[model samples]
Structures are given as structure tokens and as C-alpha cells.
Target: MVTTAAQIGWAESAALIFRPRVGELLTNTVLLVAITVPLCAVIGVGGAWLVERTSLAGAGAWGAVLAMPLAIPAFVNSYAWVSAVPSLAGLGSGVLLATLSYFPLVYLPVRAALARLDPALEQAAASLGRGPVRVFFGTVLPQLRLALLGGALLVGLHLLSEYGAFALIRFDTFTTAIMDQYRSTFNGSAGSMLSGVLMLLCFALLLLESRARGRARYARIGSGTAAPPRRIRLRGWQLPAQVGLLALGIAALGVPAVVIGGWLAYGGGTVWMAPDLVPTLLQTLGLALGGGLVTVIAAFPLSWLAVRHPGPFSRLLERTNYITSSMPGIVLALALVTVSLFFVPALYQTTALLLLAYALLFLPRALVPLQAGIAQAPQSLEEAAQALGRRPLRAFFGVTLRLVAPATAAALAMVFLAVAGELTATLLLSPIGVQTLATRFWSLSSEIDFAGAAPYATLLILLSAPMTYLLFRQSTVLSRADASAGPAPATSAPTTAETA
Candidate 1:
């Protein structure tokens, strides 16, 4: 970053400062986040409440359905929308697309938090003559503040770094601008300047989130059998509530499913068996599997240390890793390009370099789950194994690993789905002539060949579905575990892979 900053000439820097296009990009970026994040929070929190706390029919199923959007990459959602409505290709579309795609980030965490919340305070508030709305605002909402803020932070950071979705929608943000700079001119100084600005935006977001999160502890003390919160009967609103949720699910998940399904059906003759399709799918799978495994292995020690040996240093290491992962993929790809070309030319344009980018960018996806898993494993169990004449490694394998296996698998799946769907880094760092599903889809779609892109897009969604299901299931398990054990501390935000 320092080197890139130093490379920027005063005139070029001044041009960026005064450029109308740059201003538009900044405004679009800000407006997208400002509009989208809050809307996502509202939808997510509201949906979660209805599912988890209301006596709505099929709440469990609705919960899972709400999370399915996470499986559909934002760019694919844009493709689905734009294919249906040609004019949906600007800031408004971008906001709508992103909100639909990312609201699940807020929903999952808040749902988990809601599951673990003690109902005593809420019950007491109701007893004092407070209505449902007042009780929620006065009691439930304050407790939810941390989860909501963390989720919103994730949404904001993602909006700042988003490229593919916004790019497809023709809404320029820092990420897309930097991508254009690299593509059109390989203008390192200008791209780096934009990236530097993005970094500042990310930092400001982190700072704001931290301040908003504060230091308050949300865990319940002196827990007995904490009763489940009383479910408020939807009564007259039940049918409308179900309809609302169904509509949300349709907009978020059904559209992508139907669009991809239509494409496969209509384009089956020519596009389904396109010679490159299998190769691209295989390549994408290979990279995603390799990247997922490597990232989880890399995350294990960091996760282990943070959970088993909590301290300033361990916390710092974990935080540092997250901050690195939060960087825009374009910025990370450019940094890797420069380093590889300068210090290790042999590595440039290699699969190794591309995998490294994935590992760096998606590490947190693995780390979050692994750390939670490790934290849940009892130290006494490891000690018992050790006392039974097992080595530390053996004890961990026998006890800790078994305990965390589900979480580990979930983490692996999350990272795999993320890598399979990733675009900007794959564009920059994948070996020359290599084609993954994402790059191929992007290539075809960029030329307005929705038919050609459809097969790859369908395959991407198909690939993501199981993994996304696993992630949602794992989240539910984690929530249940937290509820059983006692109140959990404010949930840490899960770092997303595509965020810059």
C-alpha cells in the first residue's frame, strides 16, 4: 500500500480528487451501502423474528429458505434480474440485488442470537403492560444491537468491495473502477489510489462498527433451565406473514432458481454440452476443493490459538487475518501480481498463486467456524485422552477433531462455495488459458451472451446448493448448542469472501 501510494504522482492524484466519474463512483458506492445495508438489516431481522419467535406455520422451513440466497452469488442474482428486465442495470438494481443476496448475513447471526436469548426479561416486560412492539424495542432490540451491528458491518464492507454484482448491474464502485483500470490500462498508480481509498473506507467501517458494538456483555448469568421464549401467535396476520416470507424467498432464491432452470431447459441443445463446460466445471471444482482444504488447514492453527490460548497476541493474530481477508479481491490480486512479478516471476499466472489468493481472501470463512468449534470442545476431554497415554496430537485428533468435525466440514463447504463463485481474483490470478465457471460466466455475460453464460451459471448454483444447505444447517446446530450451554457472548461477525 505504501509503495503504491508513493507511485501516485501529484497530478494523477489531483485528477482523481477532481474527477466527476470518481465522485460518481464514490456517491454510488455510498448510496448503495446506505440504502442496502439498512434494508437488509430490516428484512433479515424481521424475517428472523417471524421465523424464530412467532407461531408462524413452517417456521423452521422458512428459516432454511431465507438462508438459501447465500448460496446464490450476488452476480448471478444480477444476471437473473437483468435477463428478465433489460433496464434493470443501474444503482437501483444494484441495491435491490445486493440487499436480496446479502440479507441472509444479518438473518443467520440474528436468528442464532435470538435462539439463545433468555425469555425472562421479555416476559417481565410483557407483565408490566408493555405491548409486543414496546417489549421488543425496549428489551429484545437492545440485546440484538451487537448482532445487528456486526451483520450490518459485514453488509457495508461487502457493498464497498463488491464488483461482480455491481459490475453486471453497471453500477460502479471502487472495486469495479479498479478492475476497469487494470483491464483497460493496467494503470497501477490509479488503481492503487482507488484501492487505497477503498482501504480507508473499510477502516472507517471497522472503526464505526467497533464503536457501535461497544463493550457490553450480552450473556446471561446464573442460568437454570432457561425456557424458550413464548411464540406470539400470528393470528390474523399469519396468512399475510407467510405470504410476505414466501415473496421474499421468491425474490431472493426463487428467481435465481427459476432463471437458471429456464436457461438450462431452453439452452439445453447447444449450451448444456458446450465442450468447455465440463472442463470449466472440473477446473472450478479442483480450485475450490484445493483452496478450501488449504485455507482450512491454514486457519486451524490461528483458530486453535485464538480459542485455546486467548490473549492479546492471539486476538491480534486473528484480527490481522480477518482484516487481510476483508481487503477487496482486486486489491489483493493486484498486490499478489506485483509481488509475484517482482520477487517471484516463476510464480506469476500460476495455479499456486491463484490458490494463494483464495486462501488469503477466504481464510476467515474457515476460521470463524473452526474457532467456534474449538471453543466448544471441552479442555477436560483432551486432558482425559492425554492421561489415557495419548499424545497431544492424538488427543486432539481423537477428542477435539471429532467434536468439531461437523463445523470443520461446514467451514470447508463454505470456503469451497465461495471460491467456486469468486471472480475478480480468478480473473487476475488464474493461470493463463484456464477457465473456471465464474470467469467463463463473466466472459459470456460481459458480451451480453446470457445464453452462453447460462450453463455455467446454472452449474455454479447447482454446485453451491448443497454447501449452502450445510452452512445453514451448521448455523442452526451452533445456535442450538449455544442455547443449550447458556447465553453466548455477542456473536462475532463472520467475514465474507467476496468483500473486496
Candidate 2:
């Protein structure tokens, strides 16, 4: 069902978070990115090198540690810092908080890229008399360029839609300003105007990422040819590496860890075991799982139609999917709200509505990965399976589906993370008093009761740990067995990263 926003253009009204009067909001946003993006890129590269390429002790443990901050949501980190100092919501502190919250975007990709690189190149570079630092700068950095930009793109897109943290700290950005304008002034036009500008900014960042990442292949595909990437000698830098690693980890993870720990120590120990918490957990997880399954299922038809039909309408639909995905969660949720209440009243405030919102907000993520996976699976294999006494569905399942499952799983993980971290949609469209971990955390933190919110924050992080793992664990082996045994000879096309 197309929403009211689609019909009447509510987005323009909500988008005015970028209105000229709110020039400070635009300035704050640019300043936040200018500081945070570079900081994260540096941290990501340095942390990846320290954990994956250095002779640092317990690199495996360190690798997990570096990625663990991803489990900590930006809002939780912001909450902890503000709670600890009560004055860190200042502009500088917000930038620091945002940087720590997002560095994992760079770290996971760089780490995975480093893990997949052939050690021989660096070894050869060394043999040619280039020092390790020079070899890394020349060889490693180029290969990492796509993964790094990809990660930065994720953070940039996320920041464009960020609200809870910024809202909590009394900072205003396009996302927060739009919501405030809507709730307080009920000025849909102003909100839409701001949203329009934010949309432009999102596309701008995406375009930047696309250009930066053009046509770069990061992974070597063959199984037997793959070698563990070389480790550099961090002989004297061990102490520096350790100190830097500890400092970053402590600031990022330690604040949240200590806050949650103190909550558990105090009267809030039972908050972890609250009566409603389990049900809320089940509700949240159920929504994520069902949303993932349905989004992937839905994406196939959309992807297949484009892949097979190859027309202007198909291309338009494909791009429209991305447009929906790129919209801020709140904007999407409000769109759904207005549409459903007026048109599909039966669906209002229900699980189906919530899942539909998730699909609309995140469908493009599932679509792109599935499209790449399906493209790699090839049309020929499905045809061959059909020639061998199978139906179209069977051929797709046995041949195409099997080949595409890895990328599908990856797509699922990414959407799962997006849904789990989502705040604005849950805030608006969730049934009366529906207490998601995110909602509960926001509710408590809004009351200035950090202790009450800590458990939910911790639980939310734990719930998302698997996703954090998958972000870097893409280095794990592809599902090679299915492709190996297909009824037809499975011809492989290039992977997404391969075609870049």
C-alpha cells in the first residue's frame, strides 16, 4: 500500500530539518561528520592493523574486542557519557561520542579486507626493499579503499538518520529537528522541506561513496589460493598498540559496560529480569526475523523482475526501493502511520504494520545483496535445472537459491542490525506501550534515570552481538558446497565487491 506521504508529499514538510532558519542544524551535522568520519577512518585502519596485521598478542581476542563496540548503540554510549559527566553533551563531546559509536564501521571492513588480502604481496614488497609501513600504505591501503568507504558510507547514511542520541543530548540535526517541528509546531511543510534537503544530502554521500569505491575488487575468490594475510612485526609498537587499543575500547565499550554494571549492582539488578522484558525481547526478535525472511522473499521478485524484464519501469521500481530505504526511519514510520490509519486501518498498530514499516525502510539493503548473489548464481544454471525435469520454482530453489544463500544471509544480517537498532519507527508505530529494548532504553533515559535504562541497553547490545560478528566475519568461507553439486554446471559471475 502506497502511503499518504507518497500521495500527498508529507516528506517535503518533514524534511525541513534543513530549513534556512535551522542553519545551525546543518552546520552541526557537517561538523559532526567532518570530525567523526576522519577519526573513525583512522581508528578503523589503526585498529584493524593492530589486531589483524600486527604481531600483537591475542590478535583474535583483539579482533573481537574492536568489533564489539558495534554492539554498543550510539544512544547507549551517549547516555553513559552524559550520565558520567552530566556535561559531555557539549558539541565537542557529542562529536567524540559519535566517533566512538561509529568507528566499527571502518574497523570491521578494514579488518575483513586485511584478513582476505594475500600475505605474499606484502612479503614481496618487503623483498623489494620496501619497509612494512611503506608496503601497507602502498599495497594494503588501496585494497582496503572500498571496504573503508563502504563502512564510512554506512556510518554517514546512519548519521543522516540519527535522532535518539542527538535528541537526548539537546543537539539538533535534520532528523531531530524534523521530529521536533512536527510534534511541537505540527508544521508538516517545514518538516518536509527539511527532509527534502536531508534526502539530497543522503544521495550526495551515497554518490561520494560510489565514486570512491568504483570498480575495486577486495577479495580473491579461489579457495585453495587463499592465504592468511601477512602479520606485520609490531616489535616496539606493542606497548603503543596495546595502549591505543585499550584507550579506544575503554572509552567506547567501558562507559557502557560500567554504567550497566553499576545498574546491576544497585536496585536495578532486577531490571534485567523485569516481567515485561522477556515478552518485549520476543516481540522485537520476532519482528526482526519475520521482517528479514519476508524482505528477502519479497526482494527476489523485485530483483528477478528487473533482472529478467530489464525495462524503464523495472529500473524505476528498483530505484524507488532505494528511495524508501534511504528515507529516515521516522519519516518512513510517519508515512506508514498516515497511510494505514486512513487507508488500512485494520493494520494499524499491529505486527504486520510494524513489519511492513521495516520492509519499506530496509528493503533495498536486502535487494542489492540478493541481486548480486542472484546475478552471480547465473541464469544458465536455473535453465539447466529446468531442462533436467524440474519446475521453475524447483530450479530456483535447488540451483539459484543454493548459490545465493551466502549473500542472502549477509543481507539478512545487515537488515537485522538495521531493524534492531531502529528507534524512531518503534517510537511512533509500536502498539501502545510496546517496550522494545530500544524503546525501553529511550523511555528510561528520557527520565534521566540511567540506572533504569542500563539493562535494556545491555540487552539490546547482546541481542545484536551476532550481527556485529557477521559484519567482520564475512571473511568466512562461502557456501561452496551447494554450487559444487548443482545439477547444472554453475557458472560464476563476479561478486559485488569484485564488480565493485
Candidate 3:
């Protein structure tokens, strides 16, 4: 995209960059990220700490509630909010919707980290007379560095790449501007310039996160088992914690449910009778499943190379995937459109191209868990199988692959939910006549037909709910396993998630 944008005459590029419109978008995009990422980190870290470290009532159920926002796409959340409050718009609404929808990106990982942390450190700190708050700040928070940073990075990327959510609210960021530019003129220099700028922003975020992560190692080198972490009693604060969680749940999940239900009630059986609805649901399922499996397969080589042969080259290759993954779906779709039209016209507008786009845009989601899974699998087990007269391929499939099944399932669930809710790329690259739930919901919602859009939104959440549960289950199970195994070696290489 940067190359394509740079092809424009220098005078035009400079003029485009300096235009007032560009300045407005740059301001909006920067401010949005600056505000949203920190807010999400706070909410996510706070929520996870409450659920995982407190004696709050129904902690397990609240953990699921915290992740439920992810089952509803940000765009659908926007539709729900707009339906509830027609006047809601601009940066405040953008931050609210993005925070509600993406905080789980932080919560899930940090919750998992909290589960996996060695409680011995906290005990040691307590033995030194440290108070709870001070112990958390000094011991717990630093140990959570990798997970918190990973989640925050994901939130920032989502902020930069998101389009439909901000678009519906009339918030003009670079993504929205790029979409507008593309709609006005296909393959226009203006849109490419915006995309180039967006890519630069994404890279800057990557670099910032990288530096923040630093070279400090958090791994334990001891052979002792981790004791269960002691839960902090809320005591008089219990009521307030519950009230706060209730408020959050209402904002994140209740609003969407009420709005969609109201529309469904208003539309009656007629909404379900929409002739395209069932087919669209099936199409969405097929595409999501296919894209998720393909992304996992594509991620395998990169994960394997990074884990088995750590080097500068491997690290570079892994980071390159993140660079592409961070691009706005529209930017990626446009690039694919250009490449297909010029070099592979036969593949243009086909399911193959659409699936390819999905793999490119969401590779990082699959990479994180897969790398962690691969790193945990015992290479010695695979070698033992090879020595038992099995071929290398057979050994891997029988041993290492089996060991990483949970992680692979976690990766698949994450990507599947992402693809199922994806908007911009599906909008641009779906095969002719393909109408997945996202595209269908987007079309109806874009037309301001809230009642007509309700069923699709309902189906989107229902379809994603199971995968969300599976993702949470897998993460919890893996975290427990890691805890039981004690911390990773201090010399061990970091996974993609840690680097994020």
C-alpha cells in the first residue's frame, strides 16, 4: 500500500498529506488510539483482576460475561447503541463502543496470565510486610507485563483498523477516510495515501509496544510448583464491585440484547422470513470455518520456524506477518483487488481470494496461540517417535501435534470468531452473490433498517457465542497447565503473544 501510494507524483502526495482533511483524520485517529488503548487496558486489567484474584460472587460467571462483548462485533454494538441513543456520535461514542467491544482482547490474555503466574512471588512479598495494593503493584503487575501489553496492542490495532464501527457513528478516522476515498474513486491515490499513513501508524504502534516490552525476562527458573493464588476479599467493597460489574455488563451486553430484541419484537416473524437469512447464515459458517482452518495451517510454518530455529530471520518473518495483519481490512482488500486485476484476473472476486484475504488479515490471531502451543510441546517426544522407526512427519503428527491440540483449538476458535464477525474485507472480497451474516447485517444496517438488521445481528452473536466459550475454556485449561508446570525457562524464547 505504501509503495502504491508513493507512486503518485511527489507534489500530489505532499499536497494530499498537508491537506486540512488529512490533518483532521490524523488528529482523530491519533486521539482515538491515545484515549482508547489506555481505557481498555484499565478496564480489562481491572475486570480480570476482579474475576481472577478477588472473592467476588460468581467469579466464573463474571469471567464469561466479561468476554461476551467479543461475541458481538463492534459494528453491531454500534448499531445497538445508535438504536438506543440516536444522538450518540463522535469520539466519546467511538471510545465507548471500542472499549466495550475490545476490552476482552486484554481481559482474556491477562486473566490467563493471572492464572498462570507463580503465587510464590506474592507470598514472598507479603512475607516482607508488603500491603495488598503495594504487593500487586510491585509484584503482580510487573509479572502481568506480557499479557497486558499483548492485549493493549490488540486493542490499538483494532482501533486503527476498525471501519464500520466508527463509520456508523460518523467518526472520521483514516480508515473511514480511506473507505470514503475508495468509494469515490477506485484505486485512487488519495485512498492509497491514507492507507500508507495508516500503515505507518500501525508500525509506530508496533515499535512502541516493542520498546515497552523491553528485554527484561519474567520467567521463573525454580523447580517448585506454584501454589494457588489467594483471593483478595472485597469485604465492604463487595457491593461496589458487583455494582460496577453489573454496570459494565449492562453497557457491553445488555444494551445490544435489548436493542436487538426490541427490533426483533417490532419486526415480528417477518424478520425471520427474509428469504436470504438462512442461506446467509450458512454461508457465514462455511466461510468462517474455511478461513479459520486455512489461517491455522498458514500460521503453522511460521510458528514452527520461530520455535524450532529462533533467529533474527525467524523473528523478522514473524514480525512481517504482524505488519500485514495490522493493516485495515479495506487497505488489504484494495491491495488484493489491484494484484488480482493485474496479475491473476482468474482469481479475482473468487472465494479463494476472499479466504486469502482472511488469512492475511487475521494471521496474528492464529500465530499467538500456535506459537505458545508449539513451544510447550516436547520436541524430545517427537524425536523419541522418530527413533521408534516412525518417519519425521508421522512423528510430528503423532506426538507434537497431539500435544498442541488445545492451543490449536484455541487458535481456531479465535480466528473463526474474528472471520465470522469481520466486515470490511468480506465486504470487498466476497465472491459474487456471497452474503455472509456480516455483509448482510452491514447492508441492512447501512440502509438504516434496524429491524431488518436485527436478525442478522442476533445470529452473529448466537453463532459466535459457542466459539467464545471454547476460546475461554482453552485459555483457562492451558493457563492451568502452564502454572502446574511452573514458569518457562528464563532462556526460553518468547512467543508472538509475549512480543505483542
lDDT of 2 by residue, 343-404 (tens): 79988888788888888888887887888787787798889989999999988889988998
The runs of at least 3 residues in candidate 2 whose Cα sits more than 4 Å from the true structure, single-residue gaps closed, are 1-20, 214-230, 268-275, 303-320, 338-351, 368-417, 476-500
lDDT of 2 at 343: 78
lDDT of each: 0.85, 0.75, 0.89
Query: Considering summed lDDT, which 10 consecutive residues are worst modelled in model 1?
Result: 491-500
Off by over 4 Å in 1: 9-11, 373-408, 488-500
The residue pairs found clashing in candidate 1 are: 327-500, 328-500, 329-500
- Mind giving the per-residue lDDT tens digits that candidate 3 earns over 1-500? 55655577788888888899988999999999999999999999999999988899999999999988888889999999999998988999999999999999999999999998888888899999999999899999998888888889989988998998999999999988888887777756777778778888988988788778777777778865667889989999999999999999999999999999999999999999999998998899899999999999999999999999999998998888888887789888888887898789999999999999999989989998999899999899999999999999999999999999998988988888889899988887888899899999989999999999999999889988887787788778989898887775676435444555
Report the number of backbone clashes for model 2.
18
Q: Which ten residues in a row have the lowest lDDT in candidate 3?
A: 491-500
- Evaluate model 2: give its TM-score: 0.82
